[model samples]
Target chain A: MTTATDKSAANSETTAGQWIRMYRQMVSVRLFEEQVNELYTRALMPGLAHLYIGEEAVAVGVCETLRADDYITSTHRGHGHCLAKGASPDRMFAELLGKEAGYCKGKGGSMHIADPATGNLGANAIVAGSVGIATGAALSAKRLGKDNVAVCFFGEGALGQGVLYEVMNVASLWKLPVIYVCENNLYTEYTHFSETTAGDIPARAAAFGLQAESVDGQDVRAVYATAGRLIDRARREGGPSFLVCNTYRYTGHHVGDINREYYRSKEEEKHWKTERDPLKLLADWLVAQGLADSTQFKRIQSEVEAEMKKAVEFAVAAPYPSVSEAGEDVYA
Target chain B: MLETLTRELTFGQAVREALAEEMRRDPRVCIFGEDVAEAGTPFKVLSGLVEEFGTERVLDTPISEAGFTGIAVGAAMTGLRPIVDIMFGDFITLTMDQMVNQAAKVHYMSGGAWKVPMVMRTTLGATRRSGAQHSQSLHAWFSHVPGLKVVMPSTPYDAKGLLKTAIRDENPVVFFEDKMMYTKLKGPVPTEEYTIPFGVADVKRVGRDITLVATSSMVQVALGAADLLEETGMSAEVVDPRTMWPLDEKTLIESAKKTSRVIVIDEGYERYGVTAEIAAVIAEGAFYNLDAPVKRMGAMHIPIPFSPPLEDATVPTEKSVFEVARKLCGQA
Candidate 1:
């Protein structure tokens, strides 16, 4: 919400090394999702996976500002969040494939994978499911004198949920160190967000006395700058912020079986993919700044693709969890 | 074992003492809910906690069950062991997504990698005339979940001891305190700290004719019924399975086998309720030992009415339980 200091604009004040690392994470998530898409199409992965193809910048930008012990609550489309929060693709892919070596030991599959060691509290399938969790984590940080901050990621669809407002009310009232990032992808399932949502989202958050702002999610630098300011402010006990990121999804809500064309024309989808793809936008920005050349970007892309390939191989070769383990995790 | 002196304490005082003691014993323990801090919640069960623990620990939350319940889960997932005072049991329906879905499934879905060591403290039962919205014994709904532990304490002693154990447990626990008994139920609670482990049922009365398995507010009702049966030259055993989910099936089934007749009493509605579950466990485990079929008694299927007389009729009275027991024992 603090727009006065746009340090990350053009990757300002951030080192070239940090920029490259961020770029690498975004690229890795993009290609890893591509591999996921291939596996889903080939029926190699069971159940459905929500792809984070076009929304990579939001995760990378925000997570770059977080400490390793800081927490985040995610959404159904959470691959980008996990990867950006430092969950290795091998375990993530293993989770998606229901492998024994997966982050969740395959129990959580894709939509529910959790890697607590990496500060990814876990992903939730229910919309706005973890808003309270993020707030509670912030409450813990404040009460326990911990320096950790908790960031919650949901969609514009979550704005309709009353719990979001409830948690926001307490969070702002208590000045808890939490960040609510709403990735407004313009779509909630097959419907446009506007069809089900009312008025403005940031304005609604502002009504809760929150420091709310809107950002272009396709621009990694803008997202990074805004999220960095907000997260830093949160770490300093500056209360919570509601950040609305205007973004889009390149694929259907879930993998396979759903005809997204029935809801919106392919032309509308093409507009976002061809013009506003987050990864493409960041890559283009890096090339323009001379931070990374096309050949170097291509090299990075190949390296990420190879990394994703290895991840898939590990997942495919990993064993399934034993049936004996099914009854074990029900309690402590 | 430490020899501890027992002091008379009301259920309300016992619960407050448990919270204060737990918070004092463990820095990780904190409590939050509507009207909990400044107003001491509706029942005053958290009275004086804010003064002792400060608002930083004994926080008052905005009225949002879904929001704060989720926060408790999140805080529990991190470092803090939170006790969420949900105010009323009926309102827990507002938090089903968090309780039934997230908190209940986190540890399991996370493949035992994470533990949600939190307790949801709420008031249950219908005799308070607080209307259907505020009056309900909804413990049965929570006991149905897998990862969640549900406990309903009928006595001050049980309330204090079980709460300490619940707070120390490395899992989510839904603790139900009887609303009507908060001020009226008094017992000799040990002044020293003690914890009653889950899955341990206490035999309040010994008998040979019939085993009466009771829960929450119904425990007293079953005891009253036992007294009435005793006057009629029929002895009845009363068993209180303190924790409903990690139910002490061994004690219950063994008692049922010894008596050769059993009756399950719950304040919740009968059809597919806690009674059904207990009866199923007995039928499946100790069917051959039964001389008579297991009988179940619970509140009527209709929502608890606002009228005192109607509400009294909905929940099982001592007379109703005695009648059911007499019928089960062929003494009617």
Candidate 2:
């Protein structure tokens, strides 16, 4: 890996190793979801799981720029967040599989995998649920005089959530070290983003006095660059920033939502999957830059596949918490 | 007798004192909600907090209930303890995602890895003609959640003590105060610091003929009914389940056994509401001791009307409760 003298985002020096690692992380997330999908289809998993298949760059790119001590609050589609923010694959697998050793002791499952040690506050099923949580965490960091920032990850659908705006307003008002990252995947769920949302999102946050950035969410480098600048500025008490990443999801809203012919056309899905897949873009960019070849990419895929197999196996073998355990976590 | 040793304060003033005392005692504690900072809240429960703690600590948030509530959740999960004042109880519906999905479930979802030691204070009432949204007694909805604690303070003493306790509590606490009673529900609060623990029922008046279980503002109504009952042959015990979720089932059941009859009163709707829970508890625990069918008095299953007479007709009043008790005790 090549090093910049200042280790700053402004130092746009290319590093073969860093891109390769980022690609590997994205691939692992993809492979992990594929395994989950296969198991879910096979009735090996009981509950529904929201897959983070296509929006890989948004999580990997933004999270990679964050320090280990910085925090993130994720949405229901948060598997990629857990992977990118350093959650173990097997534990998350166990949780999604309803095993006790998993994050949240399998009590939370896919929609709620919190890794406090890594500052992942868990994924919320409610739209814009973590908007406040993330901002509050940033407020806490600022109050405690820590340099760490808290990022809130929500979809374009969350733009309709009033709380998102509320948190965004005071986040900038108090000059809280928070970042609002909206992965505008062009769809809230079955509906197109344009159908429900009006006005520019970044501009909306900017109106709240936030330093706003709009970027191509499919391009990992782009997300990384913008997030880097915003996060760095926030750490130095530059207040909050909002980054709207224009992206797309390859699959339906939830795993159970397979048939989308009613609200969406197959061509739109194909356009994104074939032309703008974050994984494919990253892989191609890496290969184009001579960072890794097809053979290296294949090798990474195989390794991730193996890891996913082991993780699924562990999840399958892990036992569910006893019925008595159900009553335990309700209080401190 | 114990009330005589305390200083008398308005319900709103008692709440203000609690916020001030808590903020003074712990730097981690801060207050936020709509108009809470400079205006001191619509009900003035947080009057002078901004002057005392400064605008930074006593925050006046953008009218975003979901945002501030979730931010409070995140802040509490981290190092800071936050008290979120929802301007009106009706506005709570806007922030249900944060309160129920994030604040209520974080500790449980995180497998006890974290705690949301936050307090959400709101005002609920009917006769003021605040319309449907501003006049809901939605405590039953919160009580349904497993991880969150629900507190309803009917008097100034309970307001001060319980707010202090809720602030110190390690779990998320939803504090519901009746707006109509903020100025009217005056009582003596100790000048010195004191706290009231949850799940404890306060037996406001002792009687033998019947147990009248009430919540929040309804405690005063039930007390009024009991006073009228005293003029007749019937003796009705007034029991205020100060906190319903951690409901003192023991006290309620004990009272049921003593009185051999129960009348549960709530300002919320009668269907599937707090009254239902109380009746179910008595049935489950004191079925053999019942002299008559346990009765419930709650708001009629209709949206709170804006007209004063119509609104009063929807909610439970002293006359309504007294009539029900009179009939149950064979005094009608």
Candidate 3:
């Protein structure tokens, strides 16, 4: 088992194109979340918004290794996972705005956005709720002789849930093709994780005989390298692995939760935002390596900003689902 | 009617036959749960399944109900149709978040993009001295959810037919089998294949004086009560709404209108149980034709005890149902 501070293996084989694409994806998620916070502040979005602003690298790096047909189950703070898994921004904004053109046709809203075309099982609102679904998908892949692997993305808060341990044990025993990705963003909604979680996190998976590893979540290359190794092993019948990504949440638990002095301090948030930001770290590496310049980074940001602006406009102009449709999809 | 050979089969055998036949027809169908493979689930309901389907399909998982149940949801959204075998209904509390928050809401929340074609098979009823932890008829809990279908079978024939439909359905269905009736109850099951559609009521016995609307284990008790009422120079109709969520409201209302009185019975708790929902539906649909207020019979509000006498006293019996029917008909 690897510790939280353990550095990931070397990523010398990754080409410039893949690195730039990963950078663009992370930037897309950040811009999308910035727009979501804008929607919430303007009272355009109906439900709560749990933005994935600071933890973009974990989703982008891990999902970058997956094929379009591979399955994934996400958590409540899941816009980043959805986008990284290939969900369209226009439809996602429509869903958050409770419009008929949304991913869930306005039924699921922020906490639940699922798409079969992209093999997203759906973003679950309950903590650690989708662990079993990801494991089951792996079981289906194995039994059906398909080489697809499933990725389950959850927060450290899910460690408090007993089902996570149960599934991890069974996944190890059955040798299912799945990965348990725990994004330890430190705070589990108003309290530090240490106050709630006891014992070592990686040791929990190791006890179940799973291949447990940890990586610096702010480093997209580290996340991509570690997740790629585990996912490939799983596809080749290596069973499940638990990957703990040490990340941070730059925003409050939700958009409405603005006060932060009660749980965390301004210095802590400032240090992570300025020094350890995922986008800034990746950009610095790209610049030093002579692979990209400041001009290319600026172009990427402007492109993403334009795309997000259009998506929000489409969502605001889209119609709400008719009252008759409220009872339509309840059965099949 | 099509000519088909019929033979008496126990409830357990019928359920096993349904699983075996479905797994054979669809290569994607599989079963997983604690002691499901070789142990055949303590009751020996699935004894020969592992031998036929092999261990790959008939998997034996850890005692992690929530974990495996969540996996079933994910697998169902993908390519495979999974049957999750929960040992007892009392343990459903562990899997509620996976079922309610994940499985039940996935399809509708995804805007009908994904389907959870899965079945959760578990046991209900008491009187085996299994104590409070092992005995419970909690089908009503699943039925209360919008996106889940709840099935309760009384006879071997109904069990086989309904279980087949549940496995083939394109949504999450909770199939509750009365454990006490596994071997004790026998009925003629057809050798040829067939499926009983949801939301259709079965008229177990036809009468004109009063109606006894029952579900699952209570259906058998209702039949016995109808027999007693026949001896007392009264006619009591018995109607079984096999699936509770997609309830046969039209059939139940028709029966209530014809009989002018009704007594709803189930094996779940009396307060806020299946009986209450069915009674409400009948009252709303047949208010003008009814002669008396609808009565409900179910398990006592306390936990089922370990003692045989106390356990038996908690649930409704043939005598109690008969007395209630008699009183409703103004003959008490």
Candidate scoring better on lDDT of 1 and 3:
3
lDDT for each candidate structure: 0.88, 0.87, 0.91
Tens digits of per-residue lDDT, candidate 3, A124-222, equal 888988888898889888878888889999999999999998888888988999999999999999999999999999999999999999999999999
Q: What is the lDDT of residue B325 in candidate 3?
A: 84
After superposition, which runs of candidate 3 have C-alpha atoms over 4 Å from their true positions? A1-10, B1-3
* Pairs that clash in candidate 2: A132-B71
lDDT of 3 by residue, B225-296 (tens): 989999999999999999897898999999999999999999999999988999999999999999999999
TM-score of chain A of each: 0.95, 0.96, 0.97
For candidate 2, write residues A1-332 as lDDT tens digits: 22212334622753777778888899988888888888888988878878888889889888878877889999889999989999989999999988899999988888889999889988888888788889999999998889889988999998997777778888878899998999988778888888998877778998989999899999988887788788888888889999999888888888789899888889988998999988789888877877778999889988988888898888899999988898888898
List the candidates ranked by DockQ, beginning with the highest: 1, 3, 2
The TM-score of predicted model 3 comes to 0.96
Superposed Cα deviation of residue B122, candidate 2 (Å): 1.1
Candidate closer to the true structure by lDDT (higher is better), 2 or 3: 3
- Candidates ranked by lDDT, best first? 3, 1, 2
* Model 2 chain B lowest lDDT segment of ten: B1-10
TM-score of each: 0.96, 0.92, 0.96
What CAPRI-style quality would you assign to candidate 2?
medium
lDDT of model number 2: 0.87
lDDT of 1 by residue, B198-301 (tens): 98999999999999999989999999999999999999999999988798889999998899999999998899899999999999889999988898888899
